[model samples]
Target: MALKYSNKINKIRTFALSLIFIGIAIMYVGIFFKQSMIVMSLLMIIGCLATLSSAAVYAWIGLLSTKAVQVTCPNCSKVTKMLGRVDACMYCREPLTLDPNLEGKEFNENYNRKKQPVNKEN
Candidate 1:
């Protein structure tokens, strides 16, 4: 089975979008407890918080996106933003990299992690 790759920015945006729906679902469930004001109110408050947090996440990723490097995907020719050493094209899911050394290497999310030197003594 082939593993699918996705753009990091797009993934985060999808997650934030899901949060809005989840919050709405929570609020909808609260309707069943209409007889109990406290339960209904508590659910409503939690739902609002979830929705608001999603907005915050959107804002944060938006800011970070502005700082990401924009590059044309060699495979699709469409411009896409990338973060860290390796990322996938937003439009085509093509693997992309800013580092020349990592070019042509198998795409791995682990490439983004900082490499730590091995402690031979240990």
Candidate 2:
């Protein structure tokens, strides 16, 4: 069975890239409405906003890159950045975790969430 998980950073990067393309597509569509100045301008404005937001997302990813831990992926032996507690190798898609206790366990995104209290006998 193949794991479907992808590196969080890579996923966000893909989203950012898509946003740029979508913005450009929207702007292109605006050209079709040359006769309607109001509609064309509105589309252009929306497209510009989308492009600007994508830029902001890129900036956010830059900040996140600084916080992500850089480690050599054991599976592929390539350098990859990991965010949160669990992430996949950017190149190999091998699941990774920083927590020792969770090592060798099935990869789950929930591991990155806040842990709930476990009931125990005193």
lDDT of each: 0.91, 0.91
* Model 1 lDDT tens row, 1-122: 65679999999999999999999999999999999999999999989989999999999999999999999999999999999989999998988998998787678888898984454775
Candidate 2 overall lDDT versus native:
0.91
Residue 7 CA displacement from its true place in model 1, Å: 0.3
TM-score of 1: 0.90
In candidate 1, position 58 carries an lDDT of 100
Q: Whole-model lDDT for model 1 versus the true structure?
A: 0.91
Task: Tell me the lDDT of model 2 at 56.
Answer: 94
